[model samples]
Target chain A: MDVLRPSPSGVVAAEITIAEPMVRLRGVSKVYRSLRRNGTDVEALRPLDLNIARGEFVTIVGPSGCGKSTLLSLIAGLSPYTTGEIDIGGRPVAGPYTDLGIVFQKDLLLSWRTILDNVLIQAEVRGLDRRKAAARAAELLALVGLSGFEQFLPHELSGGMRQRVAICRALLHNPPLLLMDEPFAALDAITRDQLTLDFQRFWQRDRRTVVFITHNLVEAVFLGDRVIVMTPRPGGIAEILDIDLARPRNLAVRDTPDFARYTRRIHDLFIETGIIKAE
Target chain B: MSTRTRNHADAGHPGAIEGKPAGGLDKGEAPPMRRTRRRGAGRGFRRFYSVIATIVVLLIWEGGVRLFAVPALILPAPSVVFATLWERRDLYIAFSVPTTIEIVIGFFVAAVAGILLGILVSFSSFARSTFYPMLISSQLIPKVAIAPVFVIWFGTGLESKVFIAFLIAFFPIMISTMVGLQAIETDMVKLFKSMGASSTTTFIKLRLPAALPNIFAGMKIGMTLAVVGAIVAEFVAADRGLGYYLLYANGQLDSPGVFGAIMLLTVIGVILYYLVEWSQHLFMPSALIRAADLTQATM
Candidate 1:
């Protein structure tokens, strides 16, 4: 329970020390070579500067093709950024850090594995002792409201449940940082709301540092410590809104005037950046 | 894509809804569990009809043969074939029994060899790059064309028959296992990587299990080829086994014997296929259940 409180919008006012940020991206840039143009390089991500502190839930919201996924990948050390050095906990970011967990938009559940076995996959892969981890896995499943569905397969589950399982899988290892790419985007509106709420509760409970990507303004406002709005292609941070929402947020907070203000502020920012079209 | 059961309105299943929404519109309907009992009965009915059709075909053949009265040498009736099977039970027990033994032994040996070879190739990218080409090219060279060479290499005995079967069965197993191994879903691999899984863990948990279906697919094809290979090898050089028995009968103009041996081999192949399916279902109950559910829902 000593897990750091999940700073939904970790305000600079909190006097949080930035000495050893959980993740630091300093002037990071990524460019891709276009084969059609005889391998002429195209810029995808311009220089970026950001420090993600441990236990902070930062959500990146952007229009399509803004390289939000690329940023997450760079943090996970799954890919290399061309121009700048990335550091996690004072160490330089390198290829594929085991301490960083990720969940894709797809459930990515192995059809052959049982639900319980699927959860055990992470433990088996890392050569981690599973007996202890199994208890943690069950606990995480219960936290995600999937307590009795451990025996189910991905196909057997609804879209929302599969996503919940995916979330559970990412946290099964108790990684210091988690990266999610538009996880709730694939679910129905109702399911998405449920999973979003579930994720917020889980984050509050575990306090693992999370970097989630989405285009949904409400999700960004509701879940993140800081909503980092990204511009279009060759993405750059357009605005970083600090949300001062109270703890233990539930459906009750959803109807609050403050929630509408946050949502409206994000919509206005989206219009300014030309990401959201006026109705 | 509308699955079978969900397409009930099209096939005229009972209680079909006329205004049912297109695919993905079944949100309000009960889950598939509630539908399996009814769908299973429909499947059973289809199978029953197929059996009846097969019986009718056999009866028609029996009647035609009786009306034509063709000699057994030219065309043996279904009844005559059955009679041959019953009457020569003693002879078949000796010769055909040995033949079936060789078929089973050769098939199993080939399956193991192919799978092991596939694993070896998959383990080393270099081996897959180098050996896969040769493996595939070897298939282009007709197995029937080189039956004599196989007989020479493995010798004109069970070895030759087994080698041919091994050759025939080898490619499907190798190719399928390779595909299965290569088909390791990127997400599953990434999932493991995020968990700090070692290469060994990735293979055991994701690659190996994922390849089971592909391996089974290869095994099914290998099984059919094994029978073909055994028969081909026996044709070139052999004094026993079904392949030899058929050729010997053909030479002696013992038409009943030829038909009986052919029938026995077909039966064996069918039995082998179902055995593989049954076993796959037993080992992978979840996959089977999903497949069954999919079939029912689609039906």
Candidate 2:
């Protein structure tokens, strides 16, 4: 087990055992050229330099059209970057890497497949041991409080429950890195809070490098070890603030003075960057 | 539990004494869950009225024929049509068997070919650009105009009718398969790709299952067209089959025989259509099947 070192901000830090850099982006950038509608070039992401240590939970928060999702896609190797380099564990990302797992905004679970089969998709695609993966799938479903829903289809579950299933699928492969793009944005507040706490508990239990993108600052503060606040067009990092609060965090942690200070700092940055107007 | 039982146990209430105890209804009365006895009876009555309406029209035709003394060669009475159908039942059965075989074989061939081509076109821009336009444009030409050509090419046998049926039914299945395969949510494709899913795995696990409902819809349309194609080919050139028999009856001015053949052809088409519907229920996912059933119920 890696030993936990206190974060530099120093508020009784959780056991954040940062080891070697898991993700490295050296001046990476992306420019999307639209070919279908109008032949126009849109600079979705400016060149960025970011280093995420192994087992770090980083949340990216930005205004809409800030290309926060583009950043994730570039890292996941789902799409090619226009320039610069991205390496995971010192190896350059050439294409979709086997070491990464992704959760999208929607559950994207196959309606025809049962919950168990949907979770097993990762194993099927990766050519993993079917029996072992199925066992893990069951355990993960139980972890996410979805133990009894293995045979149900996607349409049968509520939105929050479906999102939990998607989360289970993302973790079933036990990838070193997990990329989530606003996975809980569509749920109601109560469900969102419940999932957030559940997520925090899981991350605490078994650490993995996570890059979670959200528009909600509260979520960013609640879940991330560091919140990377971003600017609007040609999205670039505006601020990177370390969330110094201790974990395992619950819904009650949000009411603390430290949590408020972190949220306020990000809120102020958003205003200064013209992402939101001060009222 | 005691409070609920006390209400039920009251002896003075006639509601408790009646056999139809719950909701205090009279004996033999319809329950609240039912569709209403009046409405159920009304639907049955409407169906009975439809049959009665058809009989009345037949009676009027029979009466008009006798009263005006219309030529028997020109128009046959209902009785004459029934009598002719009964007398030549063996002939109709014999010819219908071959036509039915042709339609079934043709439809199966079209389904297999259409789905394969659909998968090919969806995966490659080269295939899509090359075949999509040709498939769409083929529909514009009159199928009947090519029926005789099919006879010349494949000869005046089962091959000709099968070829004609396949041609007519092929387009709908092809177009529908293409549409179905492409109808997936973009995120779904991205999801599979991100998981390092191979093209084959993505196709078999994701694209194919998602396309089933749309493919089934197209197949239903193609099935009806297959029946039409077979009959049309039979009309142009066939030694036997219902269409050929109908043409033979017409030549001899056997109006009742013509009607009988036409009625049998209609019956075959109806049976084939219902078969397609039944298969859709069998193959499609339960969620989609339930959705379709709900839509049908509401409509």
Candidate 3:
């Protein structure tokens, strides 16, 4: 079991003030046995321990088979951890919670619905008032800067715009915690970087906790309040770097020395294993 | 589910990259010196030309037939057919009313039955296992071969024709709808999972709404097939209706009337087809807003 030995047990010695700590995982691991290709059992995740605070932005970065997504499934309670426990808000997570909302790599907007209708889906799913949710749907469209596109169908918007609608959907129910899995990884580079700031700007407004998963180091560092770096498969935490940079971060920061230095330091940590060497 | 996302991939129009900045360029491209409706207008023009060409073809057909003095036996010109239809108004009206009644009632029944069965198969994997094979086998057995039996079973009445129409129209809707319901983005389902949506919520919002576009497609196809099926069944046995009228005209050596019968059916088919399209436009998302962008994805 790889319980991330706190980077500085002494520095964080005082009781963690963030009420509820949101989510806590202990000794969580996942094993997937393939039935089609010779029935080989693959241990997708190694035992692990981690916690996300009530209103912190954390990003998990790794390659395709590194169990990053498996870990996410465990946290989201979509998939069971083979041998461990996950707790959310001090209660052992038996299954998924209504208090959490998620977004994915594909926007997955319903074709039959307008942008307004898609956003209302979250509240409708939770059995909240549909009329009320319908209004909140409009509010969220504006929140994501998609006010006029309330009637736009999923097929009618650009890739970036569709994703913005997705973000509105995730935030519509106002879940205290948001879990995102490579939501921007599918978009073009420019769109991706811009969306990173756009999402962070929204996160800053409400101060809700966010647990995001991404493989792009620049995106990881750009969005996270605390960047949690994981090693290759059977993965465990390798670095927990707290980003202390001042906020209201925009595209202009991408070229700054501090951004470069922080990026390089994290790059060195990953490449130390020789996978991503000096180049 | 494989079905959910797969449906999205297979859908006639995927919902990304709608209208552009007037020209045919992708939105991501840099703003040009001038907004040219070159691509957009070009497509519109193509559609315009097609309508014009169709009208021109019809006009020439009518003119050539009229000027050549072709006998009504060889070819009843469009005007003669129109005149005949108007003169025999009561005969056409009586026939059309019953035919339309059978079509409407039969269509509603088939749609409801097919959708319910499809949902049942989708929700229960066990039922799918047990029934899908039989379902497929039933589709393969030609309804024409079984029309006599249906006549015996339900009589040479409206019920028999309705039954045949339902049979012919059920499969496409079933398959499309099943595929649509299953066609869901896993991430979206998982999102519901994260938000604590139960299986029902996943089905209602993520699956049902996602499936609607394809469902509409299936319905359109099913509705069209209903008309053809009803006509076929009527051919097998019936006293009234256009199908029977066609047979009567042939027996009586009324060649113009026979051809008129065929023309009447063609018109019915075209009208039914357009009705489905128009309804889709009203109930489904506004195709106009998306058409400005989707109009370009011609392969």
Candidate 4:
């Protein structure tokens, strides 16, 4: 937390330090230009200044069209920003980098390859040794409770299972930073809960820097070390709340009084920003 | 989570974690063998019906000819056609050799050229814009009208027949492969690029496999058309093919000879088409086939 000291206005305080953050953004903004309509630039995200520490799990929650995904796109180098700079491990992110892994909302599994091969895609792309990578892929898949389903096609697995396979694929190469955009948004309530718990267990096993985006307040608080609350359109960070819940969190943690207070605080912040009308 | 009860969670099945034995390996899960076995049995049953349907159609055709009292000179009965085939099997086989040779050579040449052209056009926007219109316009011209031109240029040998077959077979494969390349999900492409995959690896591992079903689809159409092209070229000018034999028999008013030649040509076409189809199963993953079938069913 020393690397990220917040000012009174809820923005990261400007300070120079010898120790660099895992991720740092300064005056970053994105304006999507519409080719069909001339002279129309849709400002997706306003200038965003933030810093994330290594091994920290930060969950961002925002309303629809509030540019939560745009932030991920900028960091993943899938799209470019209109202004400012983004750095990962002290290197400017000029383009897609090999040191990061991303999980989209859909599983995006290639139906043609077996689940094992799909997980090994990271190694194939990075030109790593196949035998060693294959061994790691098997271990990761087993860690995710997909031990016997290595040869199964994506179509043969259930939706939750497919998403788990996607997770395994994302983590196969053991990237330092993991970017997820509503990865569990498409699942049912039960599956979502199951995955959330399983993900907590997995994340605690070997801490990797994680930035997760979701719309669920409870999910944001339960999984995040700090939940970033974002305002409505032309999205910008409203506040960052540190979750005080104990580690090795499970479904029972959701019922705790501290978890309820964290979710209530985030809910109130959303209401204040008019992201959701207060009932 | 024994393999016996895994079907309940197979693909889009509701409640993926409802009934599971606790302490099952890692989590409650089973291998994919059981689902594959059941699907294999279903496919076998479907093939059985396809064979039965072909036999029933032949039976009906044989019965109809006898019941109508057709004259042998005008309309040869199926039995007479079979007898003619048996009696002069050597002549038919001799004719088949040349036709088979022409088809194999032409089909492969067309396949290689079509695939190369397809890759060139789809990968580069410049090539696509420049050549795509010409590709379409070329297909619009009637292939039959150009068969004579090939004979005049390449001469009335195996060369002309093979060239004609290549001409007929190339378009469908090119067009279908192009469509397949375009049909790949944009997200899938982005995923590969995001992983820092080189262009060559993406094309070979991602784009190629994703496009297999469509490529094979085009190959099936091209195979049938290749048969047509070789026969048409032989009909124009040739002495060793079944097409030539059919024309010669027609001139002599030997109806049974004509029917036998026609049957032989059909068998060749079916065999070629099946060969292409069998490769589809080999090259295409079963998931893609299932998705295609499900899409057809829903549509």
TM-score between candidate 3 and the true structure: 0.83
State the lDDT at B288 in candidate 1.
41
The runs of at least 3 residues in candidate 1 whose Cα sits more than 4 Å from the true structure, single-residue gaps closed, are A1-13, A17-20, A33-38, A250-279, B1-35, B39-53, B68-70, B286-299
Interface RMSD of 3: 7.5
- Note the Cα lDDT for every prediction shown: 0.76, 0.81, 0.74, 0.81
The residue pairs in collision within model 2 are none
Which is the winner by TM-score between candidate 1 and candidate 2?
Answer: 1
Please give the distance, in angstroms, between residue B177's alpha carbon in candidate 4 and its true position after superposition.
1.3
DockQ of each: 0.28, 0.20, 0.29, 0.37
Best by TM-score: 4
Per-candidate Cα RMSD to the true structure, in Å, reads 6.5, 9.9, 6.7, 5.8
Question: Which of the CAPRI classes, incorrect, acceptable, medium or high, describes model 3?
Answer: acceptable
Better of 1 and 3 by DockQ: 3
Can you write out model 3's per-residue Cα lDDT over A1-279, one digit (the tens) per residue?
112233322224123424456789988888887878777788888788888876667888776778888887788778877898999888787766657777888898876666777787777666789887888888777766666566545665678888888888887777777888899989988777767877877676766778899988888887777788888876778778777556767877768898887788778878974447676
| Candidate 3 local distance difference test against the native | 0.74
Docking quality band of candidate 4, CAPRI definitions: acceptable
DockQ of 1: 0.28
User: What value does DockQ give for candidate 2?
Assistant: 0.20
Kindly report which residue stretches of model 2 are placed more than 4 angstroms away from their true locations once superposed.
A1-19, A34-40, B1-84, B250-255, B281-283, B292-299
Q: What is the lDDT of residue B145 in candidate 3?
A: 89
